[model samples]
Target: PAFTLESLDGVPVSLEGLRGRPVVLNFWASWCGPCREEAPMFRELSARQGSGDGLAVVGILFQETNEQSARDFIREYALAYPNLKDPRIDTGVEYGVSGIPETVFIDAEGVVQHMDRGGLTRERLNVGLEKIGVPAL
Candidate 1:
């Protein structure tokens, strides 16, 4: 599903705007333990967003009532990707999210390539990226 959610600072992050690149769309909540565990790995991958990989990492805050907590989490993790606001979890609903930490990988053509639920590991994340045609780095 296509969507445009605003960052904590109100900057719009649109799925369609990230065309021509593979996308990593993560749905997570600040209070989630699994989300916390994967934040740093995501932070690392976020740095590769605009490189030759032409990949984009984006986060959709799911079921998080406190915007400040989300902001603090981003700050603490030093995440480089765009973390968008989804106060009502609307985007999650569209994606059939039954739990936090669900990640969807989209190809350069904007086609959904893979989906992973629960925690993400380096191996699993690499596998997902592989499906989207991202090379090992």
Candidate 2:
């Protein structure tokens, strides 16, 4: 799904902007416990790839009202990846997200390789990563 949402810093982020790299779309909310659970894993994955050059781990805020809470979540998780605001749940509906924490792995060609609802485990995460051309963790 294509979308253009503002970043925490109020910069626009679009799926089209990240064309050639694999993307992990994480749909989450600051109030969600499970979203918090998988945050560090996403953080580490993005960090290992190094600063927007490799795999793109993008967070799409879901059902969240307060921007400050989202900011706090990023700060607490030490997330280096871009997190987009979706106050109207536009991206969530586009991605068919029924739950707070939904993960979608899209390949370099913008094809969705895998999708999972709820929190992530290393095993399940590896399965998705493999589809996006990353080796098993």
Candidate 3:
């Protein structure tokens, strides 16, 4: 299932727009402790994979009420990737997200490779990248 959502900057980001590249769709919330713990790893991976022909890191904010709080969280973490706000949480439901800090890896062909539940370390993320037909970071 394809979905479109607005980034924190109000720009539209669609899963369809990212079909040609491997994608890391991470579901998280501002208040989640695990989400905070894994944010640095996500930031590092996003930086490494953000350039040419690299993976796309897309963060989906879940169960968040304050948009400003989400914005602040992004700034505090110095996240350089796209973060989509899922206020109504329709996207989360579509993705079968049951908890915070869940991660879904999608390949270039838009096929899901893995669904990780809980905070992710760099090592785990690398494994998922490999599963999605991308080189380990």
Which candidate achieves the best TM-score against the true structure?
Answer: 1
**Model 1 TM-score relative to the real fold:** 0.96
For each candidate, give its TM-score against the true structure: 0.96, 0.94, 0.94
**44 in model 3: Cα distance from truth in Å?**
0.7
Highest lDDT among the candidates is held by which one?
A: 1
TM value for model 3: 0.94
TM-score of 2: 0.94
Among all windows of 10 consecutive residues in model 2, the one with the lowest summed lDDT is 46-55
Task: Kindly give the number of clashing pairs for every candidate.
Answer: 0, 0, 0
In candidate 2, what are the lDDT values of residues 62-108, reduced to their tens digit? 99888899999999999988999898897899899988899999998
Give the Å shift of residue 82 in candidate 2: 0.3
Residue 121 in candidate 1, Cα distance off native in Å? 1.0
Alpha-carbon error at 129 in model 1, in Å? 0.3
Model 1, position 98, has a per-residue lDDT of 89
> Poorest 10 consecutive residues of model 1 by lDDT?
44-53
- Tens-digit per-residue lDDT, 18-137, candidate 3: 989999999998888999999998888888775665699999999987888888889999999999988799999999999888999999999999999999888888889899977777
Compared with the true structure, what per-residue lDDT tens digits does model 1 show for residues 1-137? 89999998889989899999999999988899999999998998988876888999999999998888998999999987889998778889998888989999999999999999999988999999999999753
Model 1 pairs whose backbones collide: none
